[model samples]
Target chain A: MKEIAEKVVAGDVRTVARLIRDIDDGMPHVRDALKRLFPHTGRAYVIGITGAPGVGKSTLVDQMISHLRKNGKTVGVLAVDPTSPFSGGAILGDRVRMQRHSMDEGVFIRSLATRGHFGGLTQSTRSAIDVLDAMGKDYILVETVGVGQDEVDVVRSAHTTLIIVIPGMGDDIQAIKAGILEVGDIFVINKADRDGTDKTMSDLRLMIDMDQKKYKDGKWKPPILKTQAVFDQGVKELMDTIEEHRLYNFKTHGDLPFRKRKDRVGQELAEMVKARLIEEVIGGLVESGAFDMVVEEIVSGKLDPYTACERIVIPVLGKRP
Target chain B: MVQKRRLRVMVAKPGLDGHDRGARIIARAFRDAGFEVVYTGLHQTPEQIVDAAIQEDVDLIGLSSLAGAHRYLFPRVVEILRERKAEDIMVCGGGIVPEADIPVMKKAGLKEIFTPGTTLDSIVAWVNANVKPR
Candidate 1:
């Protein structure tokens, strides 16, 4: 395990993947492996690509990977999808959408399904990010299923969120739901060749202007780039915009040592809490058959599921007051 | 560190498929059988599933595909694992896979296929017997 961690620190994808698997499997070595790899992370930039379905998010991600690779950067993509019910399975079609970049060694792509979990994010999305980050990818792209609100939550994990909208879908209300009108660090109107794109861009511009007026805090406006992803048009400009955002953040934040320190501390705290809660659930309670007893109680009509949950949680987590 | 327990299994969907009751039931069963599960959100791709599998490093990959595209999708995943040279990973599938296609799927390297109405106990037992902790 120490040898694997050492190799991963040197940016080995294989070791990184294996270590991630061990982490996911809740192996004893995982925590130590992470402790060793911690110093090697924080260099990779995370970019989130999300939007409503039919907005060409996957194709755009493929193009972005291609563009990044040309500049000699390693790219990692996490493609998120919805789970199927009738068949406990996935169509796994996102790879087909990214066929052009399939052979690229510099590009590492992974698909995550929203199977039984409800949140906008996949259960293993964080672990996948860790593996990609540890592998030393220059850019990590997270492509979500693009189902409105959930997309927003997933994008929040990224350093920069790129909300892609097609012209026809960019209505006043949709602009809010797609979270394009707010959460984006950058806006992209993909499939610009389609009709009604100019109108969509105009409406988006109006919304942005309204937002700027509403805030008036002198914050930099997120740049909106128009592109037709099918033809690979306007990709260079989009990449340039992303770089500008990075440079701006770097220059400003590098001068504010405390802000960076605070952010790092907050991130670590959140990660620690997450790891602890997961350990408690999977290790502390679930393994002891306590959870199953509650399930049994609910099944036998001794208690309702909600009450059972309250009973279990209140004792373990303690009272609020 | 917590003592290692049962293998954590993440049964995931890879694309725009919305059928999840089956996946949820499987997750519940796994929970009952004492395996940790991390269910992804929906419409995930092959890459996302593989990435999750690689990261979570479960003892097995259980995919449920009702979509007709599994023929194309599953192979690509197996190929990626092979390319990563992590082909020792166990792969399994369920959901509307016809018995006729099972042989072909198994030949293509999927170890098992669970048709509709497979008992939770059987699935759990198979996994326990076949996939041990590393």
Candidate 2:
């Protein structure tokens, strides 16, 4: 474990990749490696790109990687695709668009399957991000599975979140209705050569204007940009804007972004606590058949769900005042 | 709780093969068999495929070439994997390779070759029997 962690910190690609796979597989010993690696993280600036299917997220990410590389930044990318509900399998095709960077030493791209996870990312995504970060990547770009409104968890982990939309999806009302709207640090209208580009831009502009009052305290205002990702158009401006946002974060949060980092770590800690409770407490109940007895009682109408809940929790908590 | 590890496979169409129906079908078959399939679309060089396979930590590489470049491209993937110390990633090929070249390919470190008329079931079965996630 020590060897693996040290190799990952040394940026050994094989060790990093294998450790990430172990993380995804939910191997327990990986926690030791992660503990060793934790101190080495927080160096990589994380960027998240999310949008609907067919919005060219991968293409834009590819362009961003090239631009970052030219600026001498080593990058790591995690592209997520959904697993099939029925087969528990996934065809992770996002890397197909970014394969050009595969042979580049400075660029490491990994594709993750959203393995029964619903939050636009897999269960291991946070750990995988730490792996890449500890591997000394300057930037870590996480592209979530083509998302709908509610898969906004990417915002929790990323320093900057980019919400991408293409033309002709819908009007300004669609933007307003989406839960994703509030999460964006930048909104990109990709496929701009398409017909409704102007309309989409205006719609986004109006939406941003309506939300402008929230930024009155000198908070960063999300900017809208038009891009033709396939043609590599307007991507340079996107990179510059991302760098500007990174700088803004550094200036406001004093290099460490203490508040944002605290939020992320707090969320992670809560999740770990929940998982441990499920594994130890609930798993013990199920193994000892107490859980089944409660379920049977509920099914027979002998106990209501709320009463059964108290019956389980009161034992664990020893009768609250 | 220990979760069962799923086999990850890379379905790549190496060389300039624009015909990818075979590759896509195999990729879907792998998915149906509960394998995580990373499909490297259309034209990819051996180097790109090897690099991706390593980074993904995939257990197998399914190379499809209908463009008759399999003789060079298929074995080249295995060669590069060996050179990169990733020969643990098994290489298998499908599509228009003649029966005469099968032995040579096997000798060149391709674990198996599936010509036309191969059923998706047999491929999945072979993978199930052979590939173990590292």
Candidate 3:
């Protein structure tokens, strides 16, 4: 285990993948692995790519990765695809399209399934990002589950969020949910090869212009850029816009960088607490048959679940106060 | 909430065979068994299979094909994985592979092959038992 941790800290690809699996599988010793990895994390520039499905978000990310690699940056990609909300299974085909970077030792890509866990984020997402950050990546791209709307969690988790919109969204352009509109640090009009590209850009510009509260602080205006990700066009300008946004962020919040990390720390702790409560408190009780008596009582019809819960509430957890 | 350490399996269809019924069933089976399954859509090349595995970091790659090209294409995935030193990933296949050719494919580094009539239970159990922990 120590050897694995050492290798992961040394940026060994195999060990990094294995440890991430450990975290994904909820292995018992994952805590120890994460402990060893923690000190090495929180360094990578985390970027979140989000949009409605088929906005060419995946292709754009694939292009962005190649560009980043050419500029001598080591990259890690996390592609989040929504699993069957019922079955917890997903068709994570994003990597199939990203085969160009398969042999590149500098890039580590992993697909994450929402797994019946939601909140715009999954618990495993943080652990996965930490593993990548600890592995010495220059940048980490988190492609959100593209399920749209509730995915604003990316804004919380990523330092920069890129929202991709294709030209000719028509009514769909107005259909952009309020949550999606507010999270973009940068907007992209993908499939610029298609007609109505200018109309799409103008519509987005007008919408951004109307969001008065977004510019009240006058910090930054989300730039709308164009791209034909399949052909790899306009990606260089997209990267330039991202770099400019990164600089803008640092210039604005550099003095209180710790504040950002502190926010992340708070989020991580909340997630850990939630997970622990579910596993240790709830799962332990169920496994220990503590719920059996409650079940029996309910089954006998003498006790309603609410009544039984009230009866056992104090025993299960010390008085609320 | 805490999620189970579900095994992740990638079921990919390589070559031009578009008979996705088998792949879809297996993907659903793996999911129902509480394992995460990622199924690559049809017409994937051997390179795409290997790349998907590397990127997704899956514990198992189940290549589903009815195209009679398993003999030629299945081994190519294993070979590329070996070349990249990703032998830790378990490679398996299903869909119309002949029983007689199973050993030959295994010899070339295909870990297991499940043809028609194989139960999803058996495949799930095999994975639980044989997946490399790394």
Candidate 4:
């Protein structure tokens, strides 16, 4: 485990990918490997790109990868694809779009299926990013499985989020998807060569103006830029704007948010407690048949869950008045 | 020794083979049979397939070719995997290959060849019995 963690931190692609797979599978070795990797993380800048299906998110990400590479920055990409509801499998197509960098030594790209995990990512998306961070990537790009109004979960996990839109797609509604609007640190109007480009930009400009609260909290004003990702136009400015945001974020937020840091600790603690209570503590008692007695009463309609809670839950709680 | 782990398979089409029915059916079959299948979209080069196999850490690669380039394409994949020291990843082939060429391709290291009438169940069973996990 220590050797695997050391190889991952040394940027071995095979070991990094293996550790991420282990984490996603919840294998026992992941905890030890991650504990060894923890000291090397928090270095990479995580950028998230999200948009409705067919908004050219992958194309834009491809351009961003090229731009970042031209500046000599090592980049890692986590491309998420939706699981097919019927097959429980995914066609991870984003890597296909970014195939130009497939053999680039400085670039590492991993494709993930949403796999029934919420927020358009696998449940271990955070762990995957942490492994890539430990692998010494200068920038980590997380492209979500495609976004609906409520698919802002992956964006919330990133330090910077880009909400992409295309012309003639009723660009107004997408700009204000309630959830994405809160998380979008930058908005890109991709496919700017198409018609209705002016309308899309105008609608977004007005919407951004109306979102005063987005600016009032000493929050950075989200920039709306246009690009034809296929032609690689305006991508340099996108890269420049991203660098500006990074510098600005460092000056303002300073590494990490104290409140979010505290919330992360609290959340992890709650999850650990919940797992122990459900899997180890209550689980053992349930196996002892105390749970079956309550279940049998419920099955016979002799006890309600509320009363069952009173009778069976008190003993599990260990102490009560 | 057999180990308890999900088999990761890459069902890829190398070269300009536009016919994907065989690959798609096999990929879906593997998925339904409880394997993790990564299907590379069409027009993948041999290098790309090998690269994907390594990045995905797949145990098996099911190469589908109808373009008759499997004679050329399939061996290139096996060679690259060997170059990358990933030769433990088993390779299989499906699609429109002449039966006469099957022996030569297998000699070049394709572990199995599935023709038009091959059943998905047979392929799944073969993989379950043959897949190596550590």
Q: Which stretches of candidate 1 lie over 4 Å from their true place?
A: A23-28, A85-88, A115-123, A148-151, A170-175, A178-180, A214-218, A255-268, A271-275, A282-289, A292-310, A317-320, B1-134
Q: Which residue pairs come into collision in candidate 2?
A: none
Better of 2 and 3 by lDDT: 2
- Cα deviation of B6, candidate 3, in Å: 1.7
Highest lDDT: which candidate? 2
Model 2, TM vs. native: 0.92
lDDT of 2 by residue, B23-100 (tens): 999999999999999998988999999999999999999999898988899989999998999989999999999999
TM-score of 4: 0.85
Instruction: Score each candidate by Cα lDDT.
Output: 0.70, 0.86, 0.79, 0.78
Each prediction's number of clashing residue pairs:
31, 0, 1, 0
lDDT of 3 by residue, B13-130 (tens): 8898989988988888888766677777778888877776765777788998898999999999999888878888889988898889999999999888898898989988888789
Candidate 4: residue A166 Cα off by (Å): 2.1
lDDT of 3 at A122: 55
Candidate 4 lDDT over B1-134, as tens digits, reads 01135567888989998988778888888878767777777889999888887888778999998888889999899999999888988998888889998998899999988888888899889988988653
Best by DockQ: 2
TM-score of each: 0.68, 0.92, 0.83, 0.85
User: Candidate 4: which stretches are off by over 4 Å?
Assistant: A117-123, A146-151, A171-176, A255-321, B1-4, B132-134
Each candidate's DockQ score against the native complex? 0.11, 0.65, 0.45, 0.39
What is the model-wide C-alpha lDDT for candidate 4?
0.78
Q: Give Cα distance to truth, residue A7, candidate 1, Å.
A: 2.2
Question: By DockQ, is 1 or 2 better?
Answer: 2
Q: How large is the interface RMSD of each prediction?
A: 8.6, 2.2, 3.2, 5.4
| Candidate 3 structure quality by residue, lDDT tens digits, A37-138 | 777876788898988888988889999999999999999998887777766666676775676676688888887776654342456777788889888998
